[model samples]
Target: MRRPVESAQYTSGQYARFARDHGVRLSVGRKGQCWDNAVAESFFATIKTELLDRQSWPTKALAHKAIFEYVEGWYNTRRRHSSLGYLSPAAYEATQETATERAVA
Candidate 1:
């Protein structure tokens, strides 16, 4: 027999509260709208391919540490993201700052 799981992780109440607190609009994806989640899926796929798939974790603590290092140390600061014009997230942010300053001056 197959076990059934909750379809959504967040409840309407929780989502409504979050949206109210954050001042952002939130909407549930309509059925069969897979493209709505494509970017998030792509990010996770990259993370798994670049970091998680390579490591063998013996414990939850080890896995958490590895994930933290990959996300904070390597992925955020060092890895070049093609979506961000082949720059790391940090570098892209820095370039944006320079461009903003140039625009102001």
Candidate 2:
């Protein structure tokens, strides 16, 4: 079942507000862009396999904390991704920043 359009719009608007407050550049692409969704699907799949499927959470609060720790502690800082030249997300981002700074200089 699909969500009501009004509810979807409300959620999207809330996300846009949150993104703006966080200085996030939201990627608005034309419809039918498989590439845009693929990355997120891959991440969700990996997280499901690694964290969600491994154990059960007694409480939503605990689950949220675990998810936060998994992403921040291990996934971003240490997990090597093939698409990122086998570098962790944090390392890849750092390199990208350095490259951008050098190009600007």
Candidate 3:
């Protein structure tokens, strides 16, 4: 399950009960600020649009495997991000690694 993002509504007492019941930690953004969760929200939106919305799975295991493959195989290695100058995340990381090595040398 995803982490809870709403504030105030989920007090410490509520979070404790939720955590105990679900065995998952609940996280909240700082008071009145919503940007803290934007990155995760954006990621889920992307995955839903590109992966989840396009397919159906007969089983949970199949769905999990498909998600794993979509993230590692396509999203990390092939999908381009405008923020990264249209480079795939793996490409951006490789370029960063190369720059670091050159600086070290």
lDDT of 2 by residue, 28-99 (tens): 554446687677889999999999999999999999999999999999999999889999999999999999
Off by over 4 Å in 2: 1-31
Q: How many backbone clashes are present in model 2?
A: 0
**Candidate 2: minimum summed lDDT over ten consecutive residues — where?**
3-12
**All candidates: TM-score:** 0.63, 0.70, 0.65
lDDT tens digits by residue: candidate 1, 1-105: 995543664435566688879997755575456776786787899989987899788899999998898889998899888779999999999999999999999
The Cα local distance difference test for each model comes to: 0.81, 0.87, 0.84
Question: After superposition on all CA atoms, what RMSD does each candidate show versus the true structure?
Answer: 6.5, 5.9, 6.9
Q: Which stretches in model 3 have alpha-carbon errors above 4 Å?
A: 1-6, 9-33
Estimate, for each residue in 1-105, the C-alpha lDDT of model 3 and write its tens digit: 998765565555677687779887666655667776875787799999988889787899998999999999998899998778899999999999999999999
Q: How far is candidate 2 from the true structure (C-alpha RMSD, Å)?
A: 5.9
The prediction achieving the highest TM-score against the true structure is 2
Q: How do these models rank on lDDT, best leading? A: 2, 3, 1
Q: Give stretches of model 1 more than 4 Å off.
A: 1-24, 27-36
Which clashing pairs does model 2 show? none
Candidate number that wins on lDDT, 2 or 3: 2
